[model samples]
Target: MASSVTKEISYEELKALVGKSQNLLLVDVRTKDEVDKGRISGSVNIPVDSVEAAFAMEPEAFKAKYGVTKPPLDAPELVFHCQMGKRGGTATNTACKLGYVNARNYAGAYKEWCEKEGK
Candidate 1:
């Protein structure tokens, strides 16, 4: 069973994890239009509304649809973010319920990312 505790990721921690590539899956829970404006590089857009179904997909099906391999239940780190973080927190909860034990929300989100990056 997955823990009930909600996990969160800091911008500094997320920043450090970004370049390692293989160790984490960055999921953006913002809409495609919002994501079009900008997003944390290396993050995949998976609008919050579709999160449950998306995670339920067969790995091949998910990859075919999203163009990225689906992270397994035990994936090292499955990080979610949105423009300001609320949706990301919701997505994180959804993922956790689906057995993504390592799921975390980037509480700072893209807004913080942009501010930190001076954009």
Candidate 2:
């Protein structure tokens, strides 16, 4: 896979998206245990280590596993996050490598989500 610049989204922008019913997929790269505590309301968990494989799966298989449609390669809004930001960056890179050109990292991640939500 070729190296590619990882795009990022700000907390403000993410908050706006979450408030809308737009075509968005927020992939949480946290472990099940961590995610079990809480997450951005509409996000999905697909642990960091499995990002590449998850994106590689056929759409049907992905849907079966993730319970959401597998985003297409050209999906306009594919965002990844984790406890903080590091793993989110890693997952974004992985997606970019697989040709998800619009994939982005939520730089503030779940911690920022909780803080902003006053959790």
Candidate 3:
């Protein structure tokens, strides 16, 4: 069945979610090089520039990398974050257009998370 898209959490809410053992799909839409500096725990690395490519990958390839089966155009819950809100917001929009039912943009992104969490 087709599912409805929704933003179930804000940046602060996402921080709480991070503390809990939730089955969340947290994506760091930053370059691999940038992620080498630091990143949120439990986040998958999918550079914003490569999201389209990643989504277009074969199911088995995508699953091997992301650990989830191919998500329908609108099936999984995705939380995208970048250095600042800009890239994350853009990534979120793209994912929504691609049919992610619950794609959220973490406005604070990594910078905010680092500042708040003192990382």
Candidate 4:
């Protein structure tokens, strides 16, 4: 695994990123059942269990299914989140291994987001 595979961001930093980056890709790496309870608005659904599968299969297939487009080095960041940030961090690491330079893990994932969003 690359050293840059893990990049964690605070909730405030995440909010700032969202505010500034229109092209940001916010991904929720949680189970379908968990997501049914509640999730951040506009976050793409990608179950954590399936991440390894995506990497095992064709990378482009995963990208297409998730609507992720390849961007230049200066492209907007890709933010991932999960129930408590563990899965999100894992996903971010995997994404980085697959060449996503701007992959970031939202440390205060759905749990913190929900509290802050007053859910």
* Residue 111 C-alpha lDDT in model 3: 89
Candidate 4 per-residue lDDT over residues 6-117, each given as its tens digit: 8888888877766567787788899999999988877888898776566445647767887765344344567889999889988888877777778788988999988887
Q: Which parts of model 1 are misplaced by more than 4 Å? A: 1-4
Summing lDDT over every window of 10 consecutive residues in candidate 1, give the lowest-scoring window.
1-10
Q: What is the TM-score of each candidate against the true structure?
A: 0.94, 0.94, 0.81, 0.78
Q: What are the lDDT scores of the predictions, listed in order?
A: 0.91, 0.91, 0.77, 0.78
Local accuracy of candidate 2 as per-residue lDDT tens digits, 1-119: 22449788999988888859577999999999999999889899999999999999999999999999998889988999999899999999999999997999998999988998899
Q: The CA-based lDDT of model 3 is what?
A: 0.77
> Compared with the true structure, what per-residue lDDT tens digits does model 3 show for residues 1-119?
12334253566778777857455678899989999999999888888888877877888999998776666665445688889777777777778877676788887788888988888
16-88 per-residue lDDT for model 1 (tens digits)? 8997858788999999999999988899899999999999999999999988999989998899999987889
Model 2 misplaced stretches (Cα beyond 4 Å)? 1-4
